[model samples]
Target: MIDGAAKSRKAQVHRMRRIFLFTLLSTFAISAQNKEKPTVQATPAPYEWPAEKDKKYQISSTFGESRIDHFHNGIDLPGEGSKVLAPKDGRVLYRINSEFTPGEMPYGGGNTLILDHGDGSNATWSGYMHLKTFADAVIKNAPIAKGEKLGTSGNTGHSGGPHLHFFIYHPGERAMLNPLLFLNDLYYRDTKPPEAKEWGVLLADKFANVNPDKPFRLSADYPVYIFLQDHGVGKERWGVFEYKVRLDEKEVISTKFDRIFFKEGAWSLATGHKFEDIFYRNLYALTPQVRRAKKVSVEAKDLKGNAFSKTFELKIQQN
Candidate 1:
């Protein structure tokens, strides 16, 4: 006795239920596989700390924070005058004698060494700065192993005290990554959040200007990196923060960070591969102007109503 429209509606509802059941099963299967894998990967430790000493040290500073002029680019491993070891077996690519300084911080990857691991991954051009001296004849291109003697830690080149200024670099990215995650095999405790810092908008250009009239396009090749710091009630917080890139108050790009979890306290935006842009010549440019406004703005909001923003004022300078 049902009409044609009712029959169509019933069919549509059945189809939707089928889709919902399929999606639920797929999600459960993926979750089960993930749970079976090691919570930590089984990569070999890069080096051995001398005498089984404590790998525990307070982080003195971080990479990519707003520096006096440039950006700090690596995590500083607190040594407390402890000897620094290689994190993995790598061939010595290059070594720098000078240490890093806040005045010339980014350049102070002091006594640095690059290692080629033959695999797709490479060590973070391990830099042991503030050192008294190398472990004797540890020269460039020398074969080095994990736990092998590199050098004693010291306060050198822009260093505050005796500690190892550790820096890890991915193969081709201009940005450095968090080494603490890669070193999960080590005995360090990580109840703290990854340090959230370097609060600034990724502009459409090198000038830090975004066009409001035009839609701001983030390169999908190289991901836009954001330094996220906690500014809320501690563990009581359990919600996602939303980020949107807009021009002239019109929402262009929007998303929520429900999956980006915090551990040991810090969070980084590197995992969001959806926004990475790499191949374009204008890595970031405020364009596609619709003649509405001349400038554009970017806004970020945490679920708790905490927000940070940056506005790019347009310019017409000729090259």
Candidate 2:
């Protein structure tokens, strides 16, 4: 039988492995005694939204979104057969046009294209997945221009629907960045901040919804979770960029999904914090640190940088 507690335990084990690997790699870099390895100083490259002039694609998903067992490594843009374009000037790494059966898909990324977007040791790669086919102008290893036609978005690979699963990766740094931050010409815009619809805590394997208006009694420490939601101009859902939790005016946890580094073959937020550490249920996650509630608070911000906050009082029971 499937259980949330069991799943959380498994994720906890995975998180421990991530920490161990990060520590091991930090001390064991292979380099000459006096010569330090060259590190890539990469930044967000200016990018046009990778779609045609009139195509209205909605931001269906965001990077580092909690995926039950993993973090979403990319953003999903859903539109009606939008023309996919090169985000910026880059050389083609390769393109694939796959023909698949009911259960078989090529590379699990159907009709995908990867573009090389960095120079020298700065090995950045951009991926356009679930494409129909590459444009005639796009050839393997050839340079492509910004706004140049790449292909049409489609339902390929392990996709459930027709959309573009776009991702940015710095292979040298082993990190996946939030692509929305680089798009200067995206179709959707959000001036609205994320909303704190409700508040609660996961105590002793049970989730208790808190009525902020009413004081609740708690004797022991418990994990807090908040229902934070974000929407675009057209009500399409999205993930936020940053958040913070506090207790009695003291900050307890802070997390941002701007970029996630690959550690020990798993995605981790900051140094630790696996998927379970940051998320519980859906859109309801706070800190793993069991906090004693006095004045519990939350500060949330959306991808467009709009911010919101909420606070509620909880009485601590004296033994």
Candidate 3:
């Protein structure tokens, strides 16, 4: 009887040990599963128009447009003395008041206001530039409501005319995003396709202009360049949404200028190349072997989904 009772106690100890091991493994499995899952970012609230009671506001220039040296950083709404409203409810992160300085030109954005919408991990910021004047209540770190009048549009800094330069950015990444994605496009009317005006080849630092209707000969290696533009409802010309380059029916370079990515804490063009190397960000370099191709094609699309294509005949120049 004593031996039998001892055996029974040993069996109970074995069962307890097995249960403990199973529980430990189950907890670890649950923890691992949770760790492998990704955190989903909450959806952001829709943004309102920045202009007050305005339906005829036009986008003079668009984001990612090729400028003289650098890409245009924001969208331009051409108007004078128009009220600039807050796009969303947020707090003023900071403001640059360059209007008081005499004989000093406001280089980039003359007078600018930055607002932060702290939405936890999906926080975003908006920048209003070239303001004529700020409201009395718009102070640094002050809370602002959507549709509130922040300031008046003006030609305060580096602006050719009175306009509001609006841009949206990710606060954490400090990268500029397309504001058109947030704003409602139904308010405006635009259905024009992007136009491919000119195509040329850069050889030995000289542009060998090519007529798309005629075949051009190029013996040495050269990079192709495209001059394209888009128009909205009015005669306002903007930038194309995306573009592609093809040689001998093979796609070589394709780019979509939807978002201007950031690198080294500064904005970069969507060329996949260094900003300094490609100042225009509209040039497509070709390999030496591919330069001998007999055909080249260029295509572009606008923000409204309108598309355009142009083909050029090429010939290898005999040395």
Candidate 4:
């Protein structure tokens, strides 16, 4: 007769194998769902551009652009002494004045203004940063009209140069939304697709050293990184709006830069949510157990629907 203890141990091993296989299958199913297109829950009201009608301005930076420490929270219109206007009807909520002082650090967004539209449940706030000063008639708790002059752009308060930092805030969630969604197509034009500068796998603390033109061996699993940027009509380097990663032709991660929020404070620039957490929905971390494919690909797109894609071959390193 067979030993009872040995039979029991064998059964346990079988059960554990089944559990592991089920988990792996479930993970792939979830990843496939994340590849679906995202939908916006709340559509914002129409708003006019905040720049002067007759003059032209260049976009210095686009929303969701990655910076050295933090992602750019708003679009930048670079111009010296450019007129800043209210995009919609709202009430001036707050204003700041940080006069330039040599050898002294001023406020983060030197000379700022916030306007509140609607009330209670539907309230939304529009923010203007790096202003030279508030408009002469603008006052606290005063109503502002659509297309009204609000201020002039300047290089004040921790700014590199003169520009208008514009953004929209959803009060209900306390998150920053991409203002490009609410603006008209006539405001700006971009026809070129985003470019993928580099793509590689992260090994431990650093990227695997391999020539990109040749096939690289990946001994261990690691997260992937894609350096992408957009180009506008003027050939300005800007930020892309969306990106996706695929493994062996199966999509693993799909993300769009639509909104962002701070985790620690209400609006601390330095400490905010991780890039993957806010934008990605599946296979975000790329743990060792999840890296089983030999082919990897990445795609990036700009706000105007221009897209770019590239694929790379990955081989499992032999011991």
Which candidate number has the best lDDT? 2
Q: Encode model 3's per-residue lDDT on 209-277: one tens digit a residue.
A: 666566567666666566687887667678877777788899876776666655543455455544433
lDDT of 2 by residue, 1-319 (tens): 1257866765554344335433432332222112322433457656788887675567788887665456767899886467998888898876766674354422456787878775654556788887877788777899988778898888876566888988887665666778877777457778888887766777786777776566665545676667777777757566677878787777877888877766655667764667777777555565544345567778888877889887777654523
| Window of ten residues with lowest summed lDDT in model 1 | 277-286
* C-alpha lDDT score of every prediction, in listed order: 0.42, 0.69, 0.68, 0.65
TM-score, per-candidate, Cα-based: 0.44, 0.78, 0.79, 0.75
- Residue pairs with backbone atoms closer than 3 Å in model 4 (clashes): none
Model 4, 157-271: lDDT tens per residue?
6566889988887655545678898876586789999886654466676554344456556666565555566898867888888767777878766667677643332232222
Clashing pairs in 2: 110-157
In model 3, where is the ten-residue run with the lowest total lDDT? 31-40
Give residue 201's lDDT in candidate 1 (0 to 100): 32
Model 3, which residues run further than 4 Å from truth? Answer: 1-43, 269-290, 316-318
TM-score of 1: 0.44
lDDT of 2 at 179: 83
TM-score of 3: 0.79
For every model shown, the clashing-pair count is: 32, 1, 0, 0
